[model samples]
Target: MNHDHHMKITLEAILPSHAARPVKCASCRTMLYTTQNDSGLCETCDEKHLNTLNFWTAAQKWEELVEMNRWFIRGDTTTAPYHIGRLWEETDPLIAQLLELHEYGFITIDSQPEMEHVSLSIAKKWHLIKQRAYLTCVLPTRHSLIPISKIDGLRTNLLARKDLLVTTYCDNTTYPTPKGQGLQDAIPLTPEYKHFTDVEKRIYTFRSTADKDKDVLTKWWEAKTRLELKQGRGKFTESRTFWANNTSRITKKGSILTGPDDGDFQAAAAMRPLVFHIAAREWDAGMEVVGMLVKMCKDMGFEKTFEKFEVELED
Candidate 1:
């Protein structure tokens, strides 16, 4: 981690009502206005209003709350930057709360404005390290090919907590995977270059707006075609294919990014679609591409492949 990076985060300020528009003072009961500087409270109370701003700024009470929120979720001591924290000074209470929760670690935050749901960071450590876990897919080349007796040993001592199985087949060779199916318990998956070409790659990309799963199924159909040809079956011939075609479309135009303003709850909630994308692949080679995807997804907490199970292959 980079010691130079300081986690700077901000909390929103709760200002007096009509601060933006000038209103009557609570004490003087005079109608002070901003447009004319003629309504609301008198000049005497204006000094008090200035003092209020000064007090809030000095207390940094909001910052304290934001930091607390981050700790509650991430259990990390880091936070966003100073400028990001300052933005909340103009925001409302709900927005302020959300920013604090985001800074702590409820979910990943992107600061980019163009990307919807983006999160922001004040500072970050630049150190890098690597570790291994079970439920991870590895390629065949990396396979240790343990004995049957050691299955329990591998599961208990080596395997990660989540077992992910993803597959893709040609349109013709595709078949419905049985419910409750998962990666092989005895054979752990790994990443290998040789297996990449064997991918039952999807032919079309899934879109949330229209005909969602149809594209995925269409690619499945392409994969199945290869399997059918091997069995001497002909081209696609299904009047009942409509259901398979449209199953994966997303009805809502969901955000792909999040930030401190979204809070921990919403940030976590936003990740479901992203994780689904990786999970829904037609087939997984255990250690090949699927393994690569899993490694990325685990860090993302499952958003890598949750949505958009469709693809458009290049010629």
Candidate 2:
């Protein structure tokens, strides 16, 4: 859940001066020193370029200048002999470009909860940028966790069964309901009481005492729902329930299920809910789906509201 408030935009490229060449300032046309003209501009002209409000226009011009000065898309040499000065300063020009982009709905900016920022490598992966020299802008974000409380609707039905196997209900017909009669009512009086009725009943003894147990169960349900939304009914049920019955060692203590062996218990108990391990296994896949959605938004070149993001979960 860790994310940064500021989205960092980085402009990186092999400047025109990366190759051995005498480049001139594209703006001022000044005969610049080799080190001073690496960016195809002298310090004064570079400052002026950064001062401009239009990033797209400036970027196009910068690309042209780099091409004019023999900037290579890919380089043969591993190292450059001279230093290329910073392309744009963090002054008014950079701010103006960011503001323009924000105003035009090309990027979004909002306050986000404090958390560890995503690493540069991760950001590059998310953005699908492989080029060495490119512009990146970090837009501030307002991100919040999808509330796990919705899982409450599924809790009683899911946990009430005697079998430890996890099950997914796609329709209301197969879904369980709250035990309205009595705990003793769950025990059938006769082996012949197999008549079909309006309600489907399967029950087990449940002692709902541990808050931690409920938390893990909530996470488990959330993961299941996300999987269902991403992969649809068939794959979600098949994949998530792969090891559902491998719970021979699990014993119920209150509402929490503890593993039979100390090692298993330790692993499960390390987290609040014993089911967290199961959910975490699917985390990467779920995040991949999320990343795909983000890439889609970027490609569409629009800022979406939080509700729009929620709509993506609709099954």
Score every model by TM-score.
0.16, 0.16
Q: Give each model's whole-structure lDDT.
A: 0.25, 0.24
RMSD of each: 22.9, 23.8
| TM-score, prediction 1 | 0.16
Whole-model alpha-carbon lDDT for candidate 1: 0.25
Q: List, residue by residue over 188-226, the lDDT tens digit for candidate 2.
A: 211122442312222212222112212121111112233
lDDT (tens digit, per residue) of candidate 1 on 1-315: 122433332222222223344554543343454433342334444443343223222222222322333332232321222111122211222243333323322122221110111122244212111111111111111112222222222222221323322221111111232334221211112222132222212111121111223322111111233344445353333221122222211212222222223222221232221111212223222332223433443443322111111111111
Predicted structure 2, TM vs. truth? 0.16
For model 2, name the residue pairs that clash.
7-138, 7-139, 8-138, 9-136, 9-137, 9-138, 10-136, 12-133, 12-134, 13-133
With candidate 2 superimposed using the best TM-score fit, by how many Å does residue 239's alpha carbon deviate from the native? 36
On lDDT, the leading prediction is 1
